[model samples]
Target chain A: MNTFFTIVAGFLLVNIAAGLVRVYLGPTPADRMLSAQLFGTTGVAILLLLSQALSTPALVDAALVLGLLAAVAVVAFVMRVPQSEREADEE
Target chain B: MSFAGLVLDGLLALSLPVLAWRALSARDLYRAVILFITFGVILALAWARLGAPDIALAEAAIGAGITGALLLNTVGGLSRKNDKDDERPDEPTDRVGRPWRTRLAVTVPVTILAGGLAWAVLSFPAPVVDMPSLVGEAVAEGEVSHPVTAVLLDYRSYDTFLEIGVLLLAALCVWSLGLSAVRSTAPEAVSGSPVLAGFVRLLAPAMVVSGVYLLWAGTSQPGGAFQAGAVLGALGVVMVLTGLLVPSLGRGGVVRAGLALGFAVFLLVGVVSMLATGGFLAYPEGFEYGLILAIEFFLTFSIALTLTALFTTVPPREKGGGA
Candidate 1:
C-alpha cells in the first residue's frame, strides 16, 4: 500500500515535468505561473514520500521549510503585482 | 520495503512528473500554482515516510511555501503588461512545434543524472558514522535530550546562526528586486473568500496549539522550535494573505522586534554566557531549560516574522540601483 502510494506519487512527478513543459509552452503568463506552482506542489509530494521511505529525520525539516517558503512566495508575489495588471490579467 | 510502502511510493513517484508536466502544459497559470502547492504538501508527506522530519519541515516551509509565493508574484507582475506578448506565440504559420534539440538537450542529461542518482541512493549502505546517533549521544550526555534540536541550536549552533543569515540574505535579495513599489491592495486577500476566512479562523487556534506542541515535544521526539515556529509563521502568512490581518509599515515595530528577537537573544545569551561562564552558547549549568526555552521562543518569533517579511516586498528608499 505504501509502495502503491509511492508509485502514485512518483507518477505525479512526471506530471510535474508536463507542468514544466506547460510553463515553457504556456501561451499566457498565467499559464506559466500555474506550471511553476504545479512543480512546487509535486516537489512537496516527493519529499513526503522520501521522508517515510528513508526514515531519516532531516528530510522533515526540509519539507517544512519548503512548505513555509512556498507559502511566502505566493503571498509576496500576489502582493507585488499591480492592481490594474491583476484586473487585466485575470483571464 | 513493505509492500504497502512500496506501492504508495510508486504511486507518488508516478504522479509527480505528470503533475509537473500538466503544470507546465496548462494554459492558465493559476491552475499551475495550485497544482504546485498541492505538490508541496505531498512532498511533505513523502518526507515523513522517508523518516526525515527535519527535511520534511524545510521542504514544506521553504520549497512549497516560499517558492509558491515568489512564483505567483512574478506571474502577477507579468500578467499586467506582458500578457499580450506572452499569450500565444507569434508563429506566422500553423501550430508551433517544440524544438527537437531542446527536448533532447533537456531529456538526455536529466535521464542520465536521475538514473545515476536513483541507483546510487538505492545501492549505498548506511554509513558507519551516523551523525544523528552521535548527536543523540551528545544530547543524552548533555542537558539537551533532543539530538536534532541540539544539533540545530546547541552542538551545531553555528550552522543555525548561518542558516538564519541565509534567510536574511534571501529576504534582502528579494527586497532588492523592488517589490515594494507595488501597492498593498491585497486583491488576493481572504475577505473575498468567505470559506477561506472561516477556515483560517478555525485553523488559527489549532495551528497555535500544534506549534507549541512541536516545540515542547522536540526534547523527546521529532519536533522543535524551527518546525513549530515555521508552522506558526504559516498561520500568520495565511491570515495575511486572506486579509484577516493587514500589514503596515507604521506599527510593525512589534513585528520588527520579533524579526530581530531570535538571533538577538541567541547572540545576547551567547555573549552573556561568555562573560559569566567563559564560553559561548553554554547555558549556565542549571539554567539550561530556561535559557533554551527563552532562545527557542525568541527564535520562533523571529523566524515567523522574517519568513513573513521575506514574502512581503518593500521598495528600496533612495539607494543607488543594483547595489
Candidate 2:
C-alpha cells in the first residue's frame, strides 16, 4: 500500500509540472488562470497521496488549507474580468 | 491494499493526471475547469481509501466542494472573446526556439524533488507501530474520548481555530475584490441549458443527503463537518451556476450569523468547558457524543456559509446603505 501511494505521488508531481507548462506558455490571462486552477486541484491530490505514503495526519490539514486558499484566489481573480467582455461572447 | 480501496486509488491516480492535462491544454477552458473540479472529488475518495477519515472529510469539503465552485464562478465571469484575442499578435512568441530547453528545465527539477520526497517517505522508519495504541494512551492517559476529534478540537485546537480564521479571511478577501459589478446577469432569468438544469436538480438533493449523512456519521466513523460543509458548499455552487441563487451585495442578518457562528460556537464550547471542567474544550466523559455533535453541526453550518460567501463575490454592503 505504501509503495502504491509513493508511485501515485510521483504521477501527481508530473501532472503538476504539466500545469506549470501551461502557466509558462499560456496565451492569455484566462489561460493562465485555467492552468493555475489545474495546479490547485492536482496539488491537493499530491498532498493526500503524500500523507498516506508517510502515514502522517498533519499533511491533511496542510492540504485542506492549500485547497481553500487556491480556490479563494481563483474566484477573486475570475470575478475581476469585465462584464463587457462577457457580454460580447454572449451576444 | 483491499480490493475496493485499490480500485478507488487507481481511479484517482489516473483521473487526476488526465484532468490536469485537459485543464491546461488551452483549447477548452470551461471544460478543463469542470474536469479539475471532478478531480478534487476523486482525490477525496483516494484519501478515504487511505484510512485517514479526517483528511478525507477535509479533502471532500475544501477540495471538491469549494474549489470547484470557485472555478466555475470564475469561468462564468470570463465568458469573453476567447481571452486570447486581446494578446499582442507579434510579441516574439517563441513557440519553437526554447521549447526543448524549457521542457528539460521544468522536468528535471520536478523529477528530482518528487523522487527525493518519495524516497524519504518510503525509507523513513515507521515512527510507531500501532496508531490505535498511541491514541489509546493519549485518551486513557489524558482522559478524552475520540482522540482524533480531541486532537483536532483540543490537543491541536490551535490549528483548528486558525483554520476557521483562514476560512473567514478568504471570504473577506473575496469580498474585497469589488465583485458586485461582475455578478452574473442573464439575458433572461435563466442561466443554463434545460438539460444542465435538470441534472443539477437531481444531483443537488443527493449531495445534500450525502453531506448530512457524512456530518452525522462523523463521530465513530469516517466523516465530519469539513466534508459535510464542503458538500453543502458544492450545492451552493450548483445553485449559483444554475442561477437558482443570485449574489447580492447585502449583509443581511442571516449572512452575518452564518459567517460568525462557527467561531462563536467553538469559543463558547471552550469557555464553558473551562468553567465546568477547569480546562479548555474538555467534554465530560459521558457527554462526548453530544458535545461533538453540537460542535460539528455549528461548524458545518459556519463552514458552508463561509465557503458560499467566499465564492459569492458580493461585496460587503457599505455602512448605512444598500447596493
DockQ leader = 1
Query: What lDDT score goes with residue B167 in model 1?
Result: 63
Model 1 scores a TM of 0.66
With candidate 2 superimposed using the best TM-score fit, by how many Å does residue B40's alpha carbon deviate from the native?
A: 2.4
TM-score of 2: 0.61
lDDT of each: 0.62, 0.61
Complex DockQ, candidate 1: 0.32
Candidate 2: regions farther than 4 A off: A1-91, B1-28, B52-62, B88-130, B136-150, B185-207, B247-249, B314-323
Number of clashes found in candidate 1 = 186
Calculate model 2's interface RMSD in Å: 9.3
Q: Give model 1's docking category.
A: acceptable
Root-mean-square deviation of each candidate, in angstroms?
7.5, 9.6
Global CA lDDT of candidate 1, please?
0.62
